[model samples]
Target: RVSMACCLNMCGAVHCSDIAILGYHRKPPMLDHEYMDKMCEIPLAIAACPTAAIKPAKITLPDGKEVKSVSVNEPRCM
Candidate 1:
């Protein structure tokens, strides 16, 4: 028989045990471009990513508002 626990305490059992269950919650951040310019600091967000998934990008809206945005590489995001 095998026993497992949720990884809330960062215990090392997951690595050495014969069968251990490890789970983590990972949800990529949603980008709200309409309010992004006023609310977020692009450079800080990019730097905060541990996996280097956030990237700087630009978009031109139909209303002709040129806004600075970010692109997230979902595959690399964790």
Candidate 2:
């Protein structure tokens, strides 16, 4: 069984389906983008999202490459 700490700490890898068993937001919030690459795992989050509100967004990376990232529709989430 994956712990919520694992999910929150590695949320970039955990998703909606995983949430069904793993729980949500296990750890305290992190404002840093150090592991942004883990955002690639958002599809799992989307799958786990009961509200179906999670969506994808195009983000311009620091290196000037455009890529997809998980974005919550609300301004607070952005």
**Winner by lDDT:** 1
Clashes in model 1: which pairs? none
Model 1: per-residue Cα lDDT over 1-78, one tens digit each: 344543333243565677777665467657788777689788976776667787988978779988998888989866
Off by over 4 Å in 2: 5-35, 75-78
How would you encode candidate 2's per-residue C-alpha lDDT over 1-78 as one tens digit per residue?
332423433444444344534445533334223345565476775665545556666677687877666666543231
Which candidate leads in TM-score? 1
Measured against the true structure, the TM-scores of the candidates, in listed sequence, are: 0.61, 0.45
Q: What TM-score does candidate 2 get on C-alpha atoms?
A: 0.45
For all the candidates, what are their Cα RMSDs to the real structure? Answer: 9.5, 6.9
Query: Mind sharing the TM-score for model 1?
Result: 0.61
lDDT of model 1, residue 40: 79
